[model samples]
Target: MNFQINKDVLLNNLIVAQKALSNKTPNPALQGIKIEVFKDHLVIITSNSDIAIKLNVKDSSLDVKEEGSALIPGKYFIEIIRKLDALKCNLSIVADNMLRIEADRSDITLNMMDLEDYPELEFSEKIKSVKVNVRTLKTIIRQTAFATSSIENRPILTGVNFKIDANKLTAIATDSYRLSQKEIELQDTYEPMDIIIPGRSLEELTKILENNNEVVELHFDNSKILFKYGNIKFQSRLLEGNYPETSRLIPTELPIRIKFNKDSLATAIERASLLSSRDGNNAIVKLSVRPDNVIEITSNSPEIGKVLEEVYPVDQIVGSPIKIAFSSKYMMDALKIFNSTEITVNFTGEIRPFIIKGEYDPEMLQLILPVRTE
Candidate 1:
């Protein structure tokens, strides 16, 4: 395509579109960014097998000399533009399908990929779509996506389950050992729907979203979901197969609940994990509530010394004394996402899973399954 645009504006949008650009794909076309030029604006498209992104660039600095389209090597094009010190850059296709880049003094040309090989992408919006607040969407992803299983053995568990019933939207993710769930209220009601989106896709989408009061339009289909925000359209392929029923996994009755300062408890666990034994990457740490109501976090390794850290409960512990051992990494990950200063850990039993909730973080829960210890 032939166009002239401000350097910063083009570079910024390229960074966002690059999230979907494939580096090691067998298809070479996926490594190229498709640039569509119109009289008023420029459109950039990038996609891999799992996700795709399309963003429109309309700025006062944009001056279109001609309207055309080209598939340029994504990596080389972005790097050439980024290194240019000029205020504006001009991109045009010359003879032999070469993309010529010209700025103040830098002149470079990159071999263009075949436009015929580029897959046609459809970004059409659905008739009825769900709208979610930008900040709330980010919150949901930040809180739940981390808990998705990274292992590929259980492929279904590698995605976050999204369920919509009326105005309520619930997102749940678990890696068997730990689980995270967050719910948010939509402005308008939508028909019941359920889907699983890959955690990696959600994580990449979240990075491109801005924190604001803007509403994100969600268009859903049977196999793919599209997120329309501002001038950007992000699409991702949904995971196949039904997600496991997670409702029964959560305990309805928690006999013992203890509130603790989030920072204090996290720090104690971090200290204990320093000398603890490991199960894979999990550093096991023990939490105990004495009859006197005092709490202790302990870790021990025969080859290393032991650590015993005392932390007082923010509120009186409920029910009988209990001791539980769990991975310190999982607990700290769940704690770091909380917005509240204080958090409550509800325990069903020493061996059963316990959940953590925050007063400020309504409708969000983090659960950890305890490990057996001697």
Candidate 2:
């Protein structure tokens, strides 16, 4: 393949593709990126069986002298681009299917794999497309992805469950102890789509998004999901199995309602967790509300002593004073996604799950299972 591409575009695409290329794979082709130079565009693809990425740079961004394709080792090829100092780069196919990458005064020829040997990714353009604002997508991932179970043994729990119906779109993730669910209305009509997207894939997608205002395109078939944005396309294998029905798990009402400054509560919990780690278990934060809207947060460890943190509430509690203990780590995770000044923490009882939601934002809710303390 002989083509001249803008250095910045080529490098950016290469960098993103490199993230999906894993060297530990038994299949050698999995470690390489397939570069196909068509009549008017250059396509770069890489996959590790679970996730695949494709980047297309049109002829408008490149000056093509010839057309061909090759599979080159993703790591070394990316290194070549990184070391090159030029505004544009040239890639050529010579004898023996060898590939040459040239930039400025430095050029390197690397052996290429046969294009036919590379695995084919069947993308489904026919599947119903679910469009979401990039900002909302990012927010959903941030608020929930962190709670996804990291253990590979339970693959289903390692993904964020996405449910789309005619009216609302909900994304939920949980590690059993805590769960986060975010819901938003769909502005346009779309067929119902229920699927589990792996947390790792969503994390990568979140990082790769350039702007929040851009609309992200989501396409799903029975087995895979394709996320298309700008010049990049990301495909992730869908996790199989019916995601547990979580709607019934969320409480309908809470007897105790406490609203506190989001920043102040987050800071207090962070400071308390530092000293309360007596064992490997995270620190426990206890919350109680007084009649005058004074909410107190306390943390205690047998060896590390105890701390008392007090903050004023936006609203007063009408029910009996409720005492509840929760993992400081879990509370902090839920607080990070709340950008609002005041956040509501609702509780039914000491042992029941508590929920965090914004004053005006009912579309998002974070639930944390309380820790039993003697």
Candidate 3:
């Protein structure tokens, strides 16, 4: 392909596209970025089979000398564009599957892959779309994606479940030990959808969607989903199999509820976990709630001694006093997503899973299972 484009613009899009380029792909074409030069715009596509990203650059932003297409190696092509000191770069296809890049005083020639070898990824524009605020979507991803299971034993648990029913959209993720759920009210409602999106894909999608005010259009089928925002289109393959029903896992009534400062609780857990280790019991911490409105957090480690801290002046405590032990890491992960000043911890029993929620925000909930410490 032959085209003249600005160095900075090309470099930025290449960096985003490189997220989908896999170095270990058995297919050589999957390791490169497909550049398609059109009469009015240029399309850059990169995919590793699991995730694909396409960036469209309009001719108004570049000097399009000719219309052609080429599949250039992603790593080398991006590196050349980033290091070039010129304002504009000229790319032309040479003889015998060779590509030449000329910018300022730098000139580089690289072998290109066959365009026919790339996978066919065509997105339909006529499909139904869901419109969501960019900022809200990003928040949902940040709060829930971290809770997804890192292990692939249960592939479905490695994705964030998106459930759209009526006018509400809920996002939930869990690793069995801990869970995160966030809900948002939708302005317009359509057909209900329940889909499991891979957590790794959402993490990469967040990076490309930096603009908070812009809305994102979502299009999905039975096996794949597409996200269109601004000049970028991102698609990811959906995991097969039904996600476990998690709504029933949440307790309808938590008898023992304690309200405490969010920051204070998080700080106490962080300090108490220092002596605890992940080797055996996974840095266990004990929370003792007393009738006198005092909460004690303590951790004991044979190798590193012990730590004890008291969190007093709790806002309120209902039902009977309780003591629970849980993984310090899991508690901290659940606490980090809250932006509220005060948080409430609801406990059904010492052995039962407890729920954590912001004092004033009802849209987010985090659940943690207690560990048995004798």
Candidate 4:
């Protein structure tokens, strides 16, 4: 392919497309990006079999010299574009399967992959699409994706479960130890869907979406899900299986409720966790509800030291006093999701899973299971 494009424009899209590049794949073409040059625009596609990204650069952004196609190594090609100091870069297929990049004082030629060997990514534009606000989608991922299981022992838990019922879209993620759930009211609804999206894919999608109020179009089939926004189309393969019914895990009645300042509680827990160790299975923080409407957070490490901090709740403590121990890391993860100044912690009992929720955001719930301590 031959084309003259603005350095920044090409670099920006390359950086985004690189998110889907497969590094360890045995297929040589899968490790590179396929560039298709048309009369009006250039298409860049990258995929690792599980996740794929296709970006379009309009003719207005580039000076098309010839209409052709080429497959360039994603890693080296992107690096060259990023390092180029010129405003515009010239790309040409100087020889069969060889691509050359020329900018101001720099000239480089890289061996290209065979386009025939590249995987054909089938994406239909006529598929059913759903519109969701970018900010809302980003918030949903940020709040719940972190709680997904990192290990693949249980493939379902490694993805975020998305359930669409009427106008509400609920996202839930859990590693059995803790769970994070967030719900968003959709502007329009047509059908209900229950699908599990890989956490790693959602995390990458979140990075591509803008933080503004624009809308993103979502399209999905039985196996793959597509997210289209601006000039980019991101597709991910859905995990097969039924996600665990997380609603039943939430307690119906939490008697011991404490509403504390979010910042105060987070800081106390962070300080307390300094003495605990994950390797020793002692990263536990004890929460003791005092009669004086104060909660004491304490952590003890036999090899290290101990820490104790008292935090007063914004609202008066309700129900009887109770003491519970949980993973400090889990508490910190839940706290980081809340932007509200005040948060509520609901405890069903000393051993049962407790929930942390923001006072202003009732749609989001964070649950942490208590850890056993002698």
Candidate 5:
């Protein structure tokens, strides 16, 4: 294909498309990015089988000398584009399957792969779609994606479950040991959707998206899901199997309630975790509630000394006095996801699962299983 595109615009699209290129694949063509020059737009596509990306460069932003297509190595193409200094770069395809790229002072020739071998992203005419704000989608995933299971034995647990109905959209991620759930209302009513998206895919998508107020179109078929935002299109395979039902784990009645500053609780747990090791993965922080509504956090290690941290709460509690031991890592993660200044920690009982919620709303909640230190 022959086209003259702005160096910066080409470079940016290459950077995003490269995320799907796989170097270790058995198929050599998979290591390259497919560049298609159409009548009015240039399309760049890359796929590692599991995840695929397609980026478009409009004709208004570039000068077209000829219309064609080629598959060139993604790594070399990106590096060369970044090094070019000219406002626009000319890409021309020549005889003997050679691709020529020229800019202000640089001219590079690369052996092009057969364009026919490059896999094309499959899209269905009929699709179920939903609208989500780009900013809200990023934040919701960031808050819960961290809790997804990293283990390989249970592959389904490694993804975040997305359930969308006429009124609400909920995203839930858990590692069995801890869970995080974020729910928000939809702007308009639509069809119901239930799907599980891999955390890794969401993580990569979050990185490429800019911090702006834009809406992303979510389209799903039987096997794959597509996320189209701006000039980019991303598609990923859905994980199989039903996600575990978490509603039963959350208690309806919170007998013991305590509201504390999010930053203070996070800081105390971080310090207490310093004494904890990988094997134990445990930090026993004892909490004692006095008659005057004062709470003390104390942790002790046999090899090291003990630490006691005290933080005053803005709201007082009237529940029975209690002491609980839990994973310091889970506590820190749950606390970090709380965007509000104050977070409420509720306990059903010392041995039962405890819940953490944002002070202002119950839409976002975290559940942690207390460990028996004795």
Candidate 6:
């Protein structure tokens, strides 16, 4: 295979394909980026055990002399191309499974991996696929993927559950202590489907998606899911097991709802958590609505000191006065994701899970289970 292309164009696509390149896998082939040179375009594929990314490069700067395929070491290839000072880069297969890289006044040779060892990844898109705006897909992943459980004991909880019914698409993630859910309307819909996608995979996918009106077609089977963008295909393995029913967990009768400025609440929690020592669990902070309707955020540490921050609600507090203690980090995580200036924290009780919602962000809610402290 021989090709020459604009350095920037080649590097940009390679960087995206590098997301799926595995570093610690048993199969060394997984660490290489498979490059397929065609008559007019180039195909780049990278994969691990969980996620895979394929990119089709058809740029004006591309000059293909021959058509073939090679598995180049992903890390070294990307680094060499990135550091190249030339505007155009030339890559071709040399003798004895070695790849030669030539740029402005630079020469490099890299050992290519055996293509036979790389797993065959099928990125075929089904006729029945769901279309979602790039920005919307990115928003849902950003809002929900963080709540996925990091613990591997319950492997299913480490993924975001994606469910489609008609034109509505819902993404939900939970770590047992906190849950994040976002819902958006799709432009077109087909069959009903539900799948759990690893949170780590979704996070990696979002990094490649640009915020725009471009549509992403989603194709899925029982075992895996594929996301097709303009010229890129991202595929991830699905988790096996049923996700816990979480609709009932969000309290419907939230009698105590208080609206607060999202920034103010976030900063208040940050200040309160500052006094908490990290030797134990996450700092547990108390949020209380005083009789005077002032919101007070307090954190106490016996070995250190205490912090109290008072904030005014955006509007009058509803229902009776209440105080709830929860992990400061969880509340901060929920508050920072809101796009709205104002947010409401709704509660069913002090011990039960309370939800945070924003008026500007419709069909999305963040639920955090309160921490109990005597």
What TM-score does candidate 1 get on C-alpha atoms?
Answer: 0.98
Q: What is the descending lDDT order?
A: 1, 6, 4, 3, 2, 5
How many pairs of residues in model 2 come into backbone collision? 0
Taking all chains together, the TM-score of candidate 2 against the true structure is: 0.93
Q: What's the TM-score of every candidate structure?
A: 0.98, 0.93, 0.96, 0.97, 0.93, 0.97
Better of 1 and 2 by TM-score: 1
Count the clashes in each prediction: 0, 0, 0, 0, 0, 0
Candidate 1 wrong stretches, greater than 4 Å: none
Q: Which candidate's lDDT is highest? A: 1
Give the per-residue lDDT of model 4 (tens digit) for 247-290: 89999998888998999999999999898655355378899987
| Candidate lDDT values, in order | 0.95, 0.84, 0.88, 0.89, 0.83, 0.92
**What is the per-residue lDDT of model 6 for residues 65-181, given as tens digits with 9 covering 90 to 100?**
989999898898999999999999899999999999999899989989999988888987888888888988999999999999999999999999999898889999999999999
Error of 2 at 326 (Å): 0.9
* Deviation in Å, model 4, residue 206 alpha carbon: 0.8
Q: Per-residue lDDT of 266-373 in model 2, one digit per residue for the tens?
A: 998887777674434677778776566677888777786888888777666556788888898889988887778899888888899988889656788889999887
**Candidate 5, which segments miss by more than 4 Å at Cα?**
125-127, 277-292
On a 0 to 100 scale, what is the lDDT of residue 372 in model 4? 77
Candidate 3 stretches greater than 4 Å from native: 277-281
Regions more than 4 Å wrong, model 2: 59-61, 114-116, 278-281, 290-293
lDDT (Cα, tens digit) per residue for candidate 5, span 1-374:
78888889888889999888888897888999998898789988899867899888885668777888889988888888888879888999988999998888888898888888876677432355788899989888898899999887999899999998887999999999899999999798988888999888888888887778899888886568888989889888888889999889888999899989889888977786766533355565656676667777767777877777776766878488787878888898888877788998899887888999896655999999887666
Which 10-residue window in model 6 sums to the lowest lDDT?
275-284
Clashing pairs for model 1 are none
Q: What is the lDDT of residue 263 in candidate 3?
A: 84
lDDT of 1 at 43: 95
